[model samples]
Target: MGRSKLDVGEIYMAESKIDARIYSEEEYLALDSDLDVKYEYFDGRVIAMAGAARKHVSITGQAVTALNNQLRDTPCEAGSSDLRVQLEGTRNYLYPDVVVWCEESRWADKADNTLLTPLVLIEVLSASTGHRDGSYKLEIYKQISGLMDYLIVSQNRVYIE
Candidate 1:
């Protein structure tokens, strides 16, 4: 789909063009630390986050809960999508739906909200970010040396990768 031209002071619409402001890694982190909404940074551009549907929220909970139950006996721990994972290679700040780690869980900063060493990452797809999630994010996540699995969960039906 072609992107529509963005107007100044206009509300953001999914799939439509916006300010497209590019942010440095440090600047993005500052925003992430204080901002209520999570913005994904890639190649210097900030992607505005969209709200998830109720069904999407439910599926995400189920996926995380199941992963936690399965890993209860092991040292590996499961975290919901709230955790921010920085791609070790590209340095893009990303939030996965479920992050499971058996390795060291280090703090990203003094704030300690971000998890830097997640071994297994899961993403619950939404309509607006499906393309980027499947293509852009998938390629970056695959490069993480410690990441064992990258699961892409579809909200429309029972599907995962």
Candidate 2:
């Protein structure tokens, strides 16, 4: 299957106005090989992810570092944005800012890139994505069976929820 092209203008437009093209799980996964950018799959809709700001990147790194430092010598492990987390039995796939999983980690497929079990999911909010991150993504992240906490960190200020 070939990867679908997305219009940058459409992606930055208002949520309701953005043109959404649905793709099957197979087609979505195939995009990994073709696209330079990362996307999040929600149900059958592929949402384009914007590049993180400098503050967003810094906060995410600090969060991951703090979590890893505290989790050292334990079963829990912290991962960065490159880790793709699947929403259990659903077709949804998201790349969180930081993810922490304890005990054995589960992979969605033989490739071992998609993580099925995440204990904690964190998102460092940006101006463009803060609203969706705090609301839409929060709701979806809550569906994970083993998810204990979902955090939304603001890059503009010292806020976390």
Candidate 3:
């Protein structure tokens, strides 16, 4: 069978309005291939997450470095924002700011990275995405049995959850 079509829904946030969209994973990937910003796909719905600010990138960098150092002598490997973790029985994929996975051989170890089971996942939050990171994404990430921890780092302060 073929994939479903994309549709727009009326989304209201107080005085602000946004268009909620639903598209198949394949359709989203086809669109994402040409876009610059990373997006998250959940059950045929697409949400374009905000890009990391300078401070957000810095914190993510440091976190990835620390995780990499910690796994230097082990089979686990650490990664940053360019990597994606497929979740929900491979129905969805998200590009977390940082990820650590034990299955190194399966990963290509490149910039556009992929991990089967990330023991740890980190997200540097922006103003537009802080709430989703804390609630929606948190709940979904927890569903992965291999995910041990999901860390959320604030862009404005030295806060890490």
Candidate 4:
């Protein structure tokens, strides 16, 4: 079957879009090996979102820095957009703008590709990706058993979702 054509903001009658291709774990891992900015996937198809803008990055940095300072000396570690999470076997891996995970001692190395289960997750929203972050990504992160607080920080006037 062919994939449905849906524009970025066009809302489908259905909430979720099922892709025709289902990627294996190997394929997902290989995609991460590339040097360019990689993307996350659900099933087999890539999920598209624009690169972070200046305001977006600023907000992200502020949030991460604050969270990192707060988490210091605790078991939790705060990370900015430097970690990826593999959700189940659905090939859904996302790099949330800011994440805080409490299991720091488990990972042997700092950059050992750990999929930390954040008790706190933050995303500095961009207009192009706000909907996806609020909806699709929101749902995906909710599936994480350890998530306690999820914040979607707006680059526009001070707002958080």
C-alpha local distance difference test of each model = 0.70, 0.78, 0.68, 0.66
Cα-based lDDT at residue 90, candidate 2: 82
- Per-residue lDDT over 1-161 for candidate 1, one digit per residue giving the tens place of the 0 to 100 score: 43222321122224434337767888887776656777766656666566778987888888788888998888877877777887654556777777887746665666656666778888888887676667656776776776788888888887887
For candidate 2, the C-alpha RMSD (Å) to the true structure equals 6.7
Q: Rank the candidates by lDDT, best first.
A: 2, 1, 3, 4
lDDT of 2 by residue, 38-71 (tens): 8778666777777787878888899899999999
Model 3: CA > 4 A from native: 1-21, 104-114
Spell out the clash pairs found in candidate 3: none
Q: What lDDT is reached at residue 91 by model 2?
A: 79
The reply for model 1, stretches above 4 Å from the true place, is 1-18
Give the winner by TM-score: 1 or 3.
Answer: 1
Top candidate on lDDT is 2
Residue 149, model 1, lDDT: 85
Question: For candidate 3, lDDT tens digit of each residue in 39-153?
Answer: 6666665666666678878888899898888889898877877777776355566778888888533442354354556799898888766765776567667777667899998
Which ranges in model 4 have alpha carbons more than 4 Å from their true place?
1-22, 104-111
Q: Pick the winner on lDDT between candidates 1 and 3.
A: 1
Distance from true position, residue 90, model 3, in Å? 5.9
In order of listing, the candidates' clash counts read: 0, 0, 0, 0
Pick by lDDT: 2 or 3, better one: 2
